[model samples]
Target: MAHPVRSDAEVLSVASEGVYHRLVLSARDAAPRVRPGHFATLAVGGPQSAMLLRRAFSIHRADVEAGTVELVVAERGEGTRELARARPGDRLDLIAPLGTPFPLPDGPVSALLVAADYGSAPLLALGEEIKRRGGQVGFILGAATADRLYGVEQARALTQDVLVVTEDGSAGLQGLVTDPLAQAVKAIDATVVHACGPMPMLREVSAIALGLGVRCHTAVEAAMACGVGICMTCVLPVVGEDGVSRFVRSCTDGPVFDGARVRWDDIGTVPPDLEGAAAMGGQG
Candidate 1:
């Protein structure tokens, strides 16, 4: 699919549980193919509201010929609430095909994809892409319990190896997904590891990848007022090539980043202001 300009799209279906919704946009006019890991920003509310910014959501599915795109959004905030209230006929303004994609590893290699809870949305499309390119896909899904787990069945349909770990032992393995992921890495010769979930989970996966000496990439979930790089809300610490450290905008530089390149330890520790001298000392 060619990169098409952003346009207004209509809601196609709203699934049960208020977590997944599908939108159909005319992608024939889209300039770029909505590749795996790419996202789109949807504008909500009328001009009267102060919350005029667009909410970024990963492209769950894209069909260029049908001019359609789908997004699986978990209703969490005001923007998402408005989106959930939208009906099949409702139209939404969309800025799509945004951000860089997760790099597809070359050659026939074993790959591990990990997702926790709603984080599974982005990985679903990515799994399909990897399979299309003749790469073996292994999925490690983590959820608090059986009920919260979504898309595992779908993922299993796409890939032969699917492992599930629930916090409460309601279903699948009773533990963190990272446990099975660690076991998989040790048991198999995986070439790449890709993950998108909570910060803690990503950090754990990153550490494992580092220790294993394999390539790992993570898709970050940061709070953003603006989906584009205009706002500095989603700035993340990054290490430069010359061993220097800097902050990069997650909106533009990435929502996806090389796990080894990010300074995960100091991620949320940075002070917004220098006012908390005592707190800094306490942490030290």
Candidate 2:
């Protein structure tokens, strides 16, 4: 497990991405321990407001030396709209550096990074780390359209090997990122596949990796009223070492998990075989 930090920091900058924005902040306490899959809960409406729930975001990038953090946020709701409009000096409260990070490879090896739309937030840090260990990286970025694509250029710059895919044919390949994933993996002989995005995309990525006998790790996304473990709102069905299937909190236990271990086929609803599962409706 990684350490976490709670602090009130100043917004450093905001970069526009059509209706989306990349929100960056200066947080001395959070930047140090933050990892690739870690996330933060932000107080969106400020200190006093009817919108009491804090919004959760993946830690896009953090600099311990510079005391800063970045979040790639979409302006889809009131909370995110507020964050998008945040200025250079506005104070924002953040509980951060949460969750375990992607495991670093033992030695140099080729890798593939898969992302969906804005889900590219966490991959840059991971890509940098992979490169640091003398590994090569290839990317498969997917989106609805070219306008929806996030960090394509940044990804290209870092890895020098990226393939773009969109449903509207507005980018590199006109289709799902998975369309060319298996071929890409084979071409590069990627030994590991790391992904961060929608569950459906993660599921497909995992299948591809498993078919190729490559390891897959994922940072999953779930809707949550609270970003911590108490709510039980973001539970997932995962098999433990004991070979027992049980509900686990995505907020605490993982936003990241071994892709092969996740019960992907039964994700949207509860597992009927689980104990006491039927009493409460859809979960895990």
Give me the displacement of residue 101 in model 1, in angstroms: 1.2
Query: Which pairs of residues clash in candidate 2, taking residues 3 or more apart in a chain or in different chains?
Result: none
Residue-level lDDT tens digits of model 2 in 142-246? 899888888888898887789999998988889998889999999899999999998999999998889889999999998877877888888888877777778
lDDT of each: 0.77, 0.86
Candidate 2 wrongly placed segments (more than 4 Å): 275-284
Across 1-284, the per-residue lDDT of candidate 1 in tens digits comes to 21435777777666654245545554445434677777788888966877878898877777766778877777788988888778787777888787776887675667888888878888888888788878888888888888677688889998778889999999899999788776787665777898988788898899999889888999888876786778788887777676666677777777788999888887865534323435655774
Global local distance difference test of model 1: 0.77
Model 2 lDDT-worst window of ten: 275-284
Question: Which 10 consecutive residues of model 1 have the lowest summed lDDT?
Answer: 269-278
Q: Which candidate number has the best TM-score?
A: 2
